[model samples]
Target: MTTTVRQILQKKNIQKIITVSPEQSILEALGLMAEKDISAVLVTEGERLVGIFTERDYARKVVLKGRTSKDTKVGELMTQNLLTVSPSHTVDDVMQIMTDNRFRHLPVVEKGVLMGIVTIGDAVKTVIDQQAETIKALSGYISGEMSI
Candidate 1:
């Protein structure tokens, strides 16, 4: 069975997503991320996703540029051109997208509505679990044949 983002979310029981406004300072977003123990925050404006603020963005746009996080707005540094995936997208699809883009986070959306986000860690875990299950089944089949 192909695993979808919805299945992943259900399996993980993850429902909440940390979000911040574009007008908010980078420091504020960082604080939220730290509080939530997340790497990224969806930059929203009245339910509209405008961008995504992440540690990578901070390192590249603020710290490396000598810009103070407290004074810099998230909109200035957040990634606006987001590559999102739909909830119906299979795990393999997302993995490929993330691999090609060299990023960790992917926003799960449906009908332009943000649902959840998945990380590289999540995808890797799913793939590993699937492989382990397959191996177990194959081993069971081989053992049954040997015993017969």
Candidate 2:
């Protein structure tokens, strides 16, 4: 059996979905991210996901372009072409998507509703945990402690 996004989310025990309005100042969004110790913030408009803002966006789009965060709207810099994943997606599936796209964060959506967010760290942790479990099972079988 493969680990699913739902399982990952449950394990993560996400308590809140941190979001910001598209019209909000980039500085405000960055402040929220800093307060939450997160690298990304979901951009929404009345419960509708519009885009996503990340630290990379600020570094490349704002600082490099000489645009002030306080003077710019998140919508102006947020990545509009989002690649989302569903709860049924496997950890490997998401990892592949992230790897191919160079994404550090991915939003979880179910039936057009934003469910949660998954970070690259989450996927890597899941993979590592799964590998450990496999190793443990193999050891148990080799020791004749469990049936194959």
Candidate 3:
């Protein structure tokens, strides 16, 4: 069976996206994130996906540099030229990309348009859930509850 990213979105039921301007200060972005209780925000110019700014970026870029977040723009530190996936792509494909790139977040794009983003945790959960189902099927077969 094929599981598309659209199916995952339908199941995940995510509704809102936190978006920020690239011109905004990292400090301002952090405050917005604290208020929203989200770990990452999509960097946008109008509706375009320019980059992603996450808590990890804050730690590595701002804190490590010893530069004041108030003085640092997200555009200067955000991850650029993002790796993206089509919404119609499979969960396996997403998992592969996330694993290979060692990235926690990925933007979903279609026809050069941004739709949404998925986290590494999301992809891993899907994989674990799928594995659980397989294990259950094997157990059922071993118990002769169904024909294999």
Candidate 4:
């Protein structure tokens, strides 16, 4: 059976989605990210996901441009042309997408509703866990402890 994004989200049990308004100051968004220990935050307008703000954006767009986070709006630096994924997508599918695009985070949406965010760390952990399970199952089968 393939592991789906829904399963990943269920396993993660994410309580709240951290988001910041487009009109908010970059400093405010950065503060929230710092407090949550996250490198990215979804930019929202009401219930609509407009863009994503990440550490990379801050480094390249703000810092390199000599822009101050306190004076800049998230909309000015956030990535607007986002690539989103649905819950039905497989773990492998998302892993490939993130890898090929060099993306560290992907937002999970279902019917245009933002569900949660998946970080590269989450994908790596899922793959590692899956491999461990497979190894254990193979070991059990070899030991005649379980039937295939």
Candidate 5:
């Protein structure tokens, strides 16, 4: 058995999630993000996943080409396709998916309902923490502080 994405689920009781209508201007999306201090917004339509808009999308699709955020609609600028995972998915499975797909964030859902977002950083931290504990255990054994 492997640890599920539920291990890395964002625990904060987020009442407000940054989101923009498909027809809304990208500029408006940016403003919402700035006000909410969020990195990405879950694009939804009355509780349906449509797409996602992230800062990377801005740099890669908009700003580099000098496209005006004010003129670009979110549906045009946002990544219409999305990669998603289930809360029951293992962290290791998520890590492999993220590494292979070059995804930084993944939305966790169960029964098609959005649960929370998990980032690559969170997975890496979990792995690092696990490694540190293993190292500590080994060091203790070598120092005769722990039994074999």
Candidate 6:
């Protein structure tokens, strides 16, 4: 059986997604992210996901460029070109994409609607869980063989 995004979503307890408007200052977004203890926040315009603002974006675009976070708009520093996945996508599929793109988070979309977000930590944990289950099954099989 394949692990799907839906399965992961079912396991997650917190469904609150932090969002920021493109017109908002980077400092404001950062404040929300800090308060939530999240590394990234979706840049939305009335439910439309326009971009993503992350810590990396802050480091490279704002800090490196000497742009003040209090004055810069999130849209100016956000990553506009995004890579997203659907609810039906397998964990392996998303793992590959995250690895290939060096992405820490991937937004989950369904029929052009944003559903949730998955992090690299989540994907790696899922893979580890799958491996542990496989190992347990193999160990059970070996024990049964020994007894037979």
Model 2 agreement with the true structure over 2-21: per-residue lDDT tens digits: 89999999999988899999
Candidate 6 residue lDDT tens string, 104-139: 989888888888888888888888998898888888
Order of quality (lDDT): 2, 4, 6, 1, 3, 5
Alpha-carbon local distance difference test for all models? 0.87, 0.94, 0.86, 0.93, 0.80, 0.88
TM-scores for all candidates?
0.94, 0.97, 0.88, 0.97, 0.82, 0.93
Candidate 3 residue runs with Cα over 4 Å from true position: none
lDDT score, candidate 2 = 0.94
lDDT of 4 by residue, 1-148 (tens): 6688898899999898999999999999999999999999999999899999999999999999999999999998899978988999888998999999999999999999999988888888889888998999999999999976
Superposed Cα deviation of residue 147, candidate 3 (Å): 4.1
Where model 4 places Cα greater than 4 Å from the true spot, the runs are none
Clashing pairs in 3: none
In model 6, how many backbone clashes occur? 0
Q: Distance from true position, residue 28, model 6, in Å? A: 1.2
Query: Runs in model 6 with CA error above 4 Å?
Result: 145-148
Candidate 2, residue 49: how far the Cα is off, in Å: 0.6
